[model samples]
Target: MKIKIISSHKILYQENIISIIAPGYHGYFQILKNHTPFISILKNGCLKLESKNVKKKIKIEGGLLQVKKNLIVIIL
Candidate 1:
């Protein structure tokens, strides 16, 4: 799946990821390949992204996340 993290000033991240873990308003949630489409409110926390050969974590203040067609978009 593909994931993009955008902020008001710039695009923070855009890459193909195997999976991702994000901080949702209710709790934390994970998204993997071919996951169902949905939207959620993000809380101030960390976003973890994983790929075949890479793993990363990003700190976010808060944002909105949308998942559709194997694309994950997060706007801060």
Candidate 2:
């Protein structure tokens, strides 16, 4: 799946990821390839992305997340 992290100034990160776990307004959730479309308000926490053997974590204050098709867009 494709993932893009965007901030006010510029694009922070954009790449293909196998899965992602993010902090939602109510709790945390995970998204994977071919997952159903989703949209949610994010909370202040960490966002985790994983692909193959690599894993990455990013801290975000709060934002919006949109998942559609095989793409995930995160705005912080």
Q: List clash counts for every candidate, in order.
A: 0, 0
lDDT of candidate 1 at residue 17, scale 0 to 100: 97
| Clash-forming residue pairs, model 2 | none
Instruction: Compute the lDDT of residue 68 as modeled in candidate 2.
Output: 98
Per residue, candidate 2 scores C-alpha lDDT tens digits across 1-76 of: 9998999899999998999999999999999889899999999999999988889999999999999999999999
Query: Which residue runs of candidate 1 sit more than 4 Å off their true CA positions?
Result: none
lDDT of each: 0.95, 0.95
Provide the global lDDT of candidate 1 against the true structure: 0.95
Q: Which 10 successive residues of model 1 have the least lDDT summed?
A: 4-13
**lDDT computed for candidate 2:** 0.95
For each candidate in turn, give its C-alpha RMSD to the true structure in angstroms.
0.7, 0.7
